[model samples]
Target: MSQLDTPRLPENASDLRSLYRAAEARAARLRVLVEAGQVLAGATPETLDAAVCEVARAAAHLAGYESGRVVEDRPGEAGDDNGLIFPLTSPGSDVTSPGALVLEGRRSAPSAEDREAVAVVCQLIGASLSARAREARLARLLGELLRGQEIERSRIAHELHDGVAQNAAALMRRLELASDGDPADLAKARDQARALVRELRRVIAGMRPPVLDDLGLVPALQHLAAEARASGMAIALEIAPDPGHRPPPAIETALFRIAQEALNNARAHAGPDVHVTLRLAYGAGRWRLSVRDDGCGFDPDAGRAAHDAGGLGLAYMRERIELLDGCLTITSAPGAGCSLLAEVPAA
Candidate 1:
């Protein structure tokens, strides 16, 4: 065979051993990357330190170093100079002082290949840490936004209940006392004032339901279903067996709001004689709330696009769920019905 066409093989035992070692190193590096991915996937503020430490240890193992550590480079603090240091830098940001990954007690100076592998691992770690930080910051902002919305709703509800509602009641009483006026005119005025009072009370309840705070989620949902029934919409509320357990106030508020929005959407879109179903279930370290209707449905993609373009009801529901680290899903088809399902961690 021509030399150019011949396949090459290791010529000696030493060469074979060298090839085997190189293969092993590559395998080790792959394993390290896989482990790092798992750590990053499950990362949270509570487990971040342990995750970083695990990544450092894996990098050190892959690079044939005795030990490695991740160090935050604080102001006025000295960093280790004896070992290889890889700075963790984020893109487009000068605000964060980069941390360092230090590898110590290497048997010999790292080869060019080894240094390259370590660099890749360091970059992975840095990106993961930066992503975790950004997620935490976004979560905080969402929490504040939800809290502000709740506060504003409470304020408006209080004003309507105490101001507008009270005035309407007083006007109704005045109409009742005017016996000298034309009987038909007085009756019509009194009815109009009473209707205004009922409408105002409904608005206040919708803005911020008192049952939600007083009796918790199940009772609040039941009350909502009763209201829907009164409005000529049939709403069925099904709660799991363990309805007594309550989540944190923020979580409860978020779930309630999401469910409320979903029901409102159904009431507005679903035609008469439609049966709406609301289900709440808790299990397996998570809780889920679902609202489903049998009325004509729209295209889910179109609905989602509309929501993205500032359809406040669905958008608000999604934001509230996401703020609590929950998931919201909408399902629909042209002739079928629409369903909204929200899930959050029970803990």
Candidate 2:
């Protein structure tokens, strides 16, 4: 055998025992790291606390501590002991309030290897928690973005519906009353004015339906269904008797916008005679809105790839749902219809 492949015998029994213990400790450290990685991989804002506790338990087991716990080191908390206390700090952050990992009931000071292993676990947990915090911050920002956009849309829609559309209708009436003009010219002018008014109304609806703000979501959806039917699309709406007693304004707005986008996509992509169904149901303190269309659907994988290349519609739907701590799911396949579903808490 090659010299590098040959195993060397230890000089003494003590040396052999030392080598064995070293190998065991190394293996334990590797196992702890693997566990830590798994925990971090599954960590999210909702399950962060449980994941941290699992990491701490594993750290304690590997470091030979009787028990371990993770404590949030808020101001005015008790001081930490001299034992293994790994401070969980995010990189390049001046804010040190993240907290610490505490290992208790240690018979003696931890060895260097043990300290290193525990530190690795602490680092993983800290980074994962930090990422979750950043995610929450980003979600809040997106929520604010959606709220601002909706408010602006509502303002513009109100202006167009009340101000511009009324003026156009009045102008059309004036054109009809004119007595000195050629009949054909007057008629053409009146037709053009009427078309303008209709187009403005459509624009107003697209900006933000006033019914959505005046009445609740159900009435707004009913109005939407009527408009769709007027446009020769077979659209049906099924709303719950009580949609969780009407969610918060933001939730309502997001759901409405999501449905609006889904419908627009169906109209654009779904072939003629596409039958679309919009359903809203409330149960268990949550509301679900689904839009399904029996139209020629594209491959979902191809759609996702296109989205990744810069499709904002689907991305916006997901962002809105995520901001509300909810879920958005789209299922579609070639020759199959597409279904868009969004569920959010009532509150």
Compare the candidates by lDDT and give the number of the best one: 2
Per-structure clash totals for the candidates: 0, 0
Worst 10 residues of 1 by lDDT: 74-83
Q: Listing every candidate in turn, what is its Cα RMSD in Å to the true structure after a full C-alpha superposition?
A: 15.1, 15.4
Candidate 2 lDDT over 1-347, as tens digits, reads 89999989799999999999999889989988998899779776788888888889889878777777887873232323534677875675422437788887775566888888888887787788777776776776676567557756776778777777776776766676665687876876677677677777767776788888888787777888888888899998998655535578898788888887787778778789999999999888888999999999877777764432322367667877977989999998877989989999877
Pairs with backbone N, CA or C atoms under 3 Å apart (clashes), candidate 1: none
Could you tell me how far off, in angstroms, the CA of residue 118 lies in candidate 1 after the best superposition? 7.6
Give the whole-model CA lDDT for all candidates, comma-separated: 0.75, 0.78
- Quickly count the clashes in candidate 1: 0
Model 1 Cα lDDT, one tens digit per residue, 1-347: 89999988999999999999999878877788878878867888788779889889878767767788888873221334445677765565423534878877775566677777777777777777787776766675566567557756776778787777777776766676776687776877767677677767777687778888987888888888898899898888899766568877887888887777677667667666788999998888888999999988778767654432322356557667776788899888876988889999876
Give the C-alpha lDDT of model 2.
0.78
Error of 2 at 227 (Å): 2.0
